[model samples]
Each structure stands twice: as C-alpha cells, then as structure tokens.
Target: MPMKKKPTNICCFLPDEIVENILHRLPTKTLLKYKIVCKRWKSLISSTSFKRLHENKSLENPVLILFSRQEGKPFLTTVDLSGAVLDRWDLASIGLQNSAFLPSPFGSDNLLCLVVDMQRFFVCNPSTRRACQICLPKASMHCPSGISKASFGYVPDRNQYVIVAKFKGRRNWRMITLSRDDVVVSAGNIDERWKIIKDSARYRVADGSPWGVFADGILYWTGDADDRRCLTCFDLWEEKFFVVLLPDEIVMIQEYQDDDQWLVELNGDLHLMYKKEGQQDIELWKLDGAGDWGWSKQDMCVAGFRARFGAHFRPVMMDEKGEMLVYNGGFMEWYKLKHEVFRMGGKGYKNIHCHAEDVILDFKLHIDTLL
Candidate 1:
C-alpha cells in the first residue's frame, strides 16, 4: 500500500484572505473575543485594512447608545430602536462613576468625546469599550473654572479630531483648541495641549452638557444676551468665532426643572426644537442656507405624542420611516409618525425618576463596532 501523508491542521492551513473574510462577517463582540484565540487571529484583526472593513459594516447596523446609571454605577447600554438590549458596557471600569460623564457628548464616526469632573477631558470609543484620559493644557491649571463652553468635532481639512472650548474670566474671554491624533494610542503617548483662539465674542456657553450642534466643520451653540437670542458659530479650521441672530419667530423656552430646548443636527442641517408658549405641540425650525438668513418652519405630527405623554416628552430623533424617538421622564418612548406610542422601558424601571435628566445630558446615536 502507498504511504499516506498525515492530515494537516485545518485552521493552520487556512489562507489569510479566507480567514479575514470569515472574520469580517462576525459581530464586533465576537471578533474582539476571537482576538485571543491565537496570535495569528490577533494580528489579522488588528490590521488597518480589517478595521476599515469592520467600520464600514458597523455603519450598516447602527444602534442607539443611552448613557444611564444603574445602582449608582454609570453604564453605557446599546439598544435597538425597538428597545431590545443588545449589549451593555459598564463605564465604571473606566473610572466614570455616578454618571459623572457629560450629556450630549459629541460623536463622530465611532468615537465619543466627553468631559469628566468638569476639568479633565477624555475621548472614548464606546463600541470597543476603550477610553483614554487626555491632559488639559497648563493654562487650565490657573483658571480651572474658566471652562465655560466645550465641544468635540472632526476636521476633515486637518484629518484630526478637534476639541473646542471657550474659557471666560473676569477680564477677557478666550477660546482654546486641542487637536487629537486620529490613530488610537496610549494616553501617556498623546499630547493633550490647549492652544488659544483669537476671538472677541463674549458669549457664555449654553446649558450644562453639549448643547451645540456640529455641522460642516463648524460648532454652533445658542447664545443669549439681554433676552436677545443668537447662534454662536465656531469655525473649527479657522479657529474663529461669529454670532448669527436667530429668527424673531423662534423663542427660547426654559424648563426650570430640566432643559426642554435642544439643538439637533438632522440630515446635515441645523434644527431647533422647543415648545411654544401655550401650544401642546412640539415645533421644529430648520436653517435654510439657500435663503439669506432665515429659518423655515417644519411641519411634524405630534398628535400621538400629546395624546399619550401630554407634552411632557422631548423629541430625540426622527428616523427615515418617519418614526420619532422621544424621552419622557427618563423613559425612552417611540412614537410612529401620526401613530401610537410605545414605552421602550418596561414597568420595572421605576428608578428612572432620578436619572431621567442625566439620560438626555450625554446620550447620542452610538454605533456598536470594534473601533
């Protein structure tokens, strides 16, 4: 009989291209866990090409990430639009305790930029559950409390993530910028320095969390002086500040208990959401760049909302299907366009009263991926 050769290991004989194709189809969590399977798998997963492929796949299946606290522990939970839980990443592991993270955290691509303890700054990839605490510049030490306004955004021109913060003191107002590297590296290896921006606008940053909307390389925040409302624009590239007067029809309504007004970015346009003085409906105004300084009114169906929640909820977002996501007393409620309302969280979520405000503070549409 002819000599038979021993059978070779199947996985060892697998080609690199074949292995990557199989791994690409797997979910992010599985790929992350599979990295420890072997050295080869780890090396394949950590490659730049594989990361780019994974990110493209992630964009197809986007998930809403809510920043909430459970039993005094701050946790980032990923959920489907139907309110089904997919995964939960405990932020406590990264030292974010007691919901200390700021609200309306600016998210671009796959990263979240948040402020912690009102002084220190950090950029986190919630999908990968990784965070790096960045150091503030030397100027912050002398005027720690001068950080009146701050936000994070991506600058395509520089191919970098820029952090914009406005500092106010007794004498002059200063705008600072910090450029974060695109590649992820150790916190120690990164330089978190602040550079002063030369501008003369003395607009105080509005709201506690990130109340600004970042669109087209510019960070916009609503500012008020002497009951006159205006939009504060910060050019990320030019590193300059300018103010635009808001339309007379739109008014800023303040909810003493919690903030009801919001600056939302929808379909690459800036929008403002607020309730009229005596109306039971929520109003939306979109900025019309075509016209010379004007905000066009948008018609939206809030009948289903007022029927159930009675104007107590805040409109979070509107999907392509015309379904609207809103927040009510800390509970997420989904209302179809001119349809009925469904409460996302079930009855066992009574502890939500204390954390409802915090939810809106730092929540954004977060995607789950290995970034």
Candidate 2:
C-alpha cells in the first residue's frame, strides 16, 4: 500500500514566523503579488498584525518615501514623508471614499495631505489608525469668498481638533471650522456644511493658492497687503488675526527678489526659510527667540556668502545630526558636518527616478534598529 501523498498545503510547509518576517519587509505593492500564492498569505497580508507591525517599525526613523510617479511621465517624485503609503488602494480599499484624497501627513505626524483636486478633507486619528472623510456644503463651494489657506489642528483645550480652511471668498475672510461634533448628518453630508467665523480683516485670495502653516494653535501664511504680499497670522483659539512683521533680513531678501518662504522647526522654534541665493549660500534666518527674519550680514557671523549667492535652489531639513540630507538631481546627497552646503556623502540616488512602476527606497538612522 502506498502512503497517501501529503496534501500540497503551503501554509503548513513554512514556519509561521518566517512567512511574517518576509512579509514585513516586502512593500505594499509586492504584497499584492503574494496574495495569489496561498490563502494563508492573503489572510496574513490583510490582518491587523501587518498594520500594527508596520506602525511599530515605522516610529524609529522617519522614512523618505517617493510618491506619485507616472508611467513614462517624468513627474516630480515626492519623497513621501508620511508613514503609511497613499495610493489608489487606501481610499477604496478602506471603503470610505470615492475618488477622494486625504491630506498627506504634515510636519512631523507622519500624516499629510487632505486630498488633491477634490473639495474633500480627511480627519484621522493617528493612534487608532482610523480616519474619516468630510465633504463641505455646495453653497460654501462657490465661496462668494475664495479659499485662501487651509490648516487643520487639534486643541486639547476644546477636546476637539478643527479643520480650519481660511477663505477670502466674496464676503469676508472667515475661518471655517469642522469637527466630529459638527457631523450633524450621517451618510449624506455636504462638503460645505461649514460655519463661517468672520474676522474684522478681509484677507485676499490671490489666484487661489493654498499655502498656510499651523503652529501653537495659530495659522500663519503670506497675504497681500496694499498690493504687496506680507506674512499674516491667525489664531484659531482666539479667533483673531494679526500680522508678523518680516525681519530686516527677510524683508531685504524679498525686496531684491522673489519672496521665497518655507517653514520648518529648528530646536523646537518655528523657522521661516527665506532664500535670496542658491543652496550654497543659503542663509539661516532666525524666526523666533532671536528676532524677526531680517538678519544683518554682520549678525550672521558666517563669512563669504555675499559674493557667491545663487537664489535658485531647494532646501530640506534633516534630523540626521551633522548630516543635512538632500536629494539633488534625483540623487541623495548629504552636507558635511559644521559646514553649511558642501555635498558630503556620495550615497546618491543615481538609479532612482519617478517612473510609473512601483518601488520604494527610504532611509532612517541606524540607532532605532536597537529599539
């Protein structure tokens, strides 16, 4: 009598631990490929274990992920800073959306973006990994006033965070706040169901640009004043508007050229990156604790920047101590320690490009590996 052949079961063949180990490293795209391998793999891939594992491994070092590469179309591949991947699957896969996008994680939370090209925004709970999309009312869409800048923030004081979309629509510069408590209706909620908090100052919406930042319960942005655009700040908690005067350095820098502004946190203080020259001569203007952005050449304490300034360049903030990381011409380069702008590390993204195919290349400090 011949022994019955053992059933060709893949799940029973490999160690459960080994399969999961391999699954953790494979990206979301590759996971889709393995779904057909066996029923067990399909189950494991969709299990909460996978999501929890990714979240745990993600907290160590921030990843530099490349997002939105078109097939053969050379779109600027965004280094997706948000922890979880955002693709066609997230909205539809989770069953909470229809061609709607969510805000990509902003600043440090590993969640940014509220969605693109659509008048929708997502409110998410990072700790629970749960999210919901909100639609505004249609009447609010035609914004008799135009949308100037939108900022979302959480205030523990009120036990509710708000999605504050600043609008300079036809009427006034109003602050539109939405919260879960504002979910008056269930399934069919309109996107414009927002209540307008009118302010005394009517901010202008120039060409419908959505550029704004939220810090310490306040929203800051660049606004037009007397035909000249300057910095503007709004307090969500206080429900008032104020202006932050540009530093002499920042003001002078803008006077001579385009008012290029970028925001980042340095040593916990919010900093405004104003570049009047190239990356090599990029000056650091102190936005807080020191003074306004107007730094004097005599105050910089650095030398040789006046003569060799190139204003056309990009800037990146890094946590890699003494290692300022930047991707130049699609290649990753690091600036040397102590020096401001000389390319140091040779580990360039020579082969990386924003191609249509799905691939992920990211970096993190090795220190967290021990965690």
Per-residue alpha-carbon lDDT of candidate 2 for residues 143-219, written as tens digits (9 for 90 to 100): 33333456655454664455556543434454444443433224345355466666644664334335555555656
User: Among these predicted structures, which one has the highest TM-score?
Assistant: 1
Clashes in candidate 2: how many?
38
lDDT of 1 at 9: 54
TM-score of 1: 0.78
TM-score of each: 0.78, 0.60
Tell me how far the alpha carbon of residue 316 in candidate 2 is from the true structure, in angstroms, after superposition: 3.0
Instruction: State the lDDT of candidate 1 residue by residue for 293-349, as single tens digits.
Output: 478776663543444665455556666776666666456656655445454443222
Please give the CA lDDT of all the candidate structures. 0.61, 0.46
Error of 2 at 363 (Å): 16
Candidate 1 wrong stretches, greater than 4 Å = 1-10, 13-18, 82-86, 98-108, 168-183, 187-192, 207-210, 252-260, 290-293, 304-307, 310-316, 327-361
